[model samples]
Target: RTVTSKMDLLAFHTNTPNESLISSENGVDLSLGSQPLENTKVHFEEKQFVCSECGKGFTHKSALLTHKRIHTGEKPFACADCGKCFTQKSKASVLKHERIHTGEKPFVCLECGKRFTQKSSLHKHERVHTGEKPFACSDCGKCFTKKAYLVVHERIHRGEKPFECFECGKYFTTKSYLLTHERIHRGERPFTCSECGRCFTEKSSLLTHEHCGSAIGCRSCTTGILTLLESCAKDMRPIGFSLSHITYCC
Candidate 1:
């Protein structure tokens, strides 16, 4: 028999103790002395707690409260060594930050036995041994070991120079180049040759000077003459100059 309501089902069960009643709405069997059919439906926990700022829903109130800290800009976890603040999402982040002060390198490479502070760094270092270049440029199809290197390489194809030198108003593709160029303005020759005690702003320049030897007097003067000869050769302008015929006088 079809049962419309809970009361009707109870009344029908009281009248006929042996017969089973089917729900009129959902066609669920309602037998006498049996549990209600409505209670047997699959239950799912609803996300009642929601973030007011971001509209993100969470099943537990505690999780919703923890997520709200992100929108509120609240960092309850602080590093003891450096006093740097981090979110309450994970305490693992705090442990990793503590490694910086403690100088702990837990991640180690199997190939070279080189240790790294973070697992990601260890993974990147492992690529060196494996010769894996996972990150590839879309334009040139050139592969790089790291994503940052690929990003810098893509800038070359686009002719993008984001880093700028304040002193000379010159732009560079990378911050390292801009910093090196600033040394010229500051007259900061950091790279020094041990042989002649001569300083150069770039290490490459110092290496070139070292290769020329102290007997050549000034390497710049010799390089200038060689460069002039090269230019003269390229222009087909015969100056009747030969490197073998020239005297070694600075």
Candidate 2:
């Protein structure tokens, strides 16, 4: 996740074999293995064949699509619960869709056994466990694990705030996010923690606390203190266990 000066998306326009090799557009070279190009039939649209695997049938096209998902696991959607992480938007969406039917949470965190239907939820949960934040913002040093979190973060950097709450004169980058935050002032509790019967104004805070505990304490340099707390809480546990865990997990 290296940040670049360019804000435009990586785009591709179909070109013939001659142009793909000769033209200046050096985008992704999406060639299908060592297979011959003349073998598969192409379906033309607007300019070029928009669908490369058009006549290749369901299995053939699906396999290509599945392969593409590997290159770009563009899971644009995310779960509102448990802060689980995912690569595919559809997968997160499908799980959320199933929530209406089963009302069950399958994905669980390793540090704490919080359950969620989406893997993204579990990922956001694991951040609480290890406190591992690898995603760093280019504008600010503040770190986050998810892209959506980063998008909101970039608002501070770009100073292009489009998300504003008419009710409070507060501004944000995204409207949906601003509306969700506005609910906090409206006395709306959307996320309820199953661990301690505590409710949160937002899902993000709830996910954060499940691992870090309430806001009364400090999270910075707290990993060093956990061993002392463990020793104070349970003398039976060895002193080095916490240190060793943090050393390896960090």
Candidate 3:
């Protein structure tokens, strides 16, 4: 039964059971009919509700209303812990951001007992033990456990260094390396040796110093040992300096 006219719509609605006409706040009586009302003349065009800013349209008025918030820069969702505002009104996003302040990691790996705030993060961490590299590079046959790592690795093949140092105009593959390089320009040695109180620009340098300090007894002895080893292994010489080297030197 196709409703071709307003009379057919009214006849169809009147025959329906437990249906009633509803009124809008503007006092427009919107009837349960297929055609447009005589008084209200409300018609739903295809993609009728359009945004004023970006000209994006939605079929539903409610969807258009929600889409308008993007142009308005409206973020109704706020974190109770840190008062941080997020554009999304979802409770899941709020809970995930709240985990930073709460330090609550509910998702745990059974293999290593390593916990993560999100289940996806725990799944990625589990791949380390499983040796599962799901994300593969198209340029090369190298694979990574996470998609983000694969994206970063692909930049190497493309020779794309998006992160650049402002002072030296030098580029780096990762943002963290760029930040670490910037610390050098600022003379910031963040990593400090607990044994000798000597600061280094990178953590790996501090770690190597700690290992040398542990093997040689003191800071002065460690420096001497490093110098002697470098002198012996100079000009790219292959020297098997292991724990036995420390024993022999001591």
Q: Which is better, 1 or 2, measured by TM-score?
A: 1
Which model, 2 or 3, shows the larger TM-score?
A: 3
Tell me each candidate's TM-score: 0.56, 0.38, 0.63
Model 3 lDDT at residue 221: 47
> Tens digit of lDDT per residue, candidate 2, span 206-237?
77656543322322335544443333344433
Model 1 lDDT tens row, 1-250: 8866657766876888789767676676667546544453312235789888988988799999888888888998877777788877476787778889899999999999999889999999999999999999999799999999998999999999999888778899999888899999999999988976878899977766666553342223554444433433333422333342232434
Question: Lowest lDDT 10-mer window, candidate 2?
Answer: 1-10
Worst 10 residues of 3 by lDDT: 241-250
Q: Give candidate 3's TM-score.
A: 0.63
Task: Give the alpha-carbon lDDT of every model.
Answer: 0.73, 0.54, 0.70
**Measured by TM-score, how close is model 1 to the native structure?**
0.56
Better of 1 and 3 by lDDT: 1
